[model samples]
Target chain A: MKKTLYPVLSVITILAFGFLVMYMLYGSGETPIFIIMAIFAIILGAAILALVWPRFSGTSTVTPGQSPFLVSRGVYFLMVIVLLVSFLLEGFNSSSPWSFLYPSENPFVPILSIAIIVGLYLVLYLRKSVREKYSFVELWTMKANDEREQHIIDDAARKTYGFMRMLVVIMGLGFFAFQLLGMSFPAFSVGYILFLFIFVAHAYFMFLLRKITD
Target chain B: MEKTANRLRELRKVRGQTQEEMAKDLGVTRQTVISIEKGEYIPSTTLALKIARLLKKPVEDIFWLE
Candidate 1:
């Protein structure tokens, strides 16, 4: 089932991207339209990278005992650094006068947009990979059959997913309350705070859940 | 963390079968057979029936309330 779909999806994505690039380079546009199109292109490009990530990337051969925390944290940190640098350069720099930039308005909507695109792809990839790959060692007994092993593996994977979900909602609330009550400046201060909480909680929970997985 | 069954394990050994051989015959992983022998996992009804058939016994005879 999966082997057939992978190649098909990859081809579709490549065709979409090729069209986007050719249209952007050859098509005509002035300042306003150009900026709008550039923003759209950047977003679409990031989304493609995320969506095709699974096809290009192989599963981490890391063992169950191995922690993916450090790697994930490093990736998250690098992302934050890039966004922060871009924000600092664009915003609060009067000489450059890029009017589109504003911290109060979170000029980094494109970054969030990229993250969302990647996240959606990851969710889909994991849903497929976890079931097919895991050996389900704990579930098999000398007396057990294939059906028994499958049932156990399926149940354990689902339980891990459920715990992750709970942790997300819990940690998200934690960050939201911390930010909203701690600081306020903008119109949707409350909403932004909630979003920030959810994002941070996702990182934190990603770290914490590794401990609970085994 | 919980009590489990190994009646199947004892029976399989009495019938003279290795974990690897049993797993092959049952179409499951060796680790599953090990887990069962160690009383770490319980077989489902279908699996229980399969095991019983292999051992030439009834399901109830092979598994009991222990």
Candidate 2:
């Protein structure tokens, strides 16, 4: 069941990602043929790499309970680096450091970012340490392996819900204040808020899991 | 208030089972076994029963109010 489901889901996710990129690049305009070709080329290249990657055997070097912490920290670091790079590029291109926060007009920015993201995701998915414990689909879905893990997940989710509720209320009030002051909310803030939502949820889950497991 | 204490570590050692071995037999991670033995986390009733079965002991024999 998983063997077939995983591949199917992978293809679907990749295709969805490609379409998302296309929409981001040419929302109302016609997408150029080369852009479509480039996206497909990148996807095909990634698929080939996944198929040809050598399978790993032997004990995982990652400590039994430490994988979540390591993965979270790595993801957080990667996001920070990506954000900084985008900021720098935006500043260099437009003389506005905050331009990257808005949707980028340069097609290369989205394409490059998508390629890097897909490439890194494939690398992590194929990593021996991660692969030994979880399948690509399991990793993608964040499936729990045991009752204890499920418990930790549930607790983490509950805490995250509480935290996000508070955060949303505060953000709502801030936005309301902005509206009263006749200030326009930046579109980039919505994207940043979504990023923060994901980051905080993962961080919370990893922190709680590590604390319990340790 | 009474605190819950457990004899999990001692009983596991008496059975000559490593944490990893116990975890495998109990269908849980070694970290779960470690946490239980250290009294850092209490197990659910089902898990407690599973552990009791693995170690050939009763639940009360493994855990008690202290």
Best by TM-score: 2
The per-candidate count of clashes, in order, stands at: 5, 0
Which parts of model 2 are misplaced by more than 4 Å?
A1-140, A186-188
What is the per-residue lDDT of model 2 for residues A91-190, given as tens digits with 9 covering 90 to 100? 3464443343455456565446546655555554455545565564453345465666666654554465345434544565565577689886654343
With candidate 2 superimposed using the best TM-score fit, by how many Å does residue A75's alpha carbon deviate from the native? 18
User: Which pairs in model 2 have colliding backbones?
Assistant: none
Q: Which regions of candidate 1 deviate over 4 angstroms?
A: A1-145, A182-214, B1-6
TM of each candidate vs. truth: 0.39, 0.52
CA lDDT of A159 in candidate 2? 60
Angstrom error at residue A25, model 2: 17
**lDDT value, residue A175 of candidate 1:** 41
Q: Which docking category, incorrect, acceptable, medium or high, applies to candidate 2?
A: acceptable
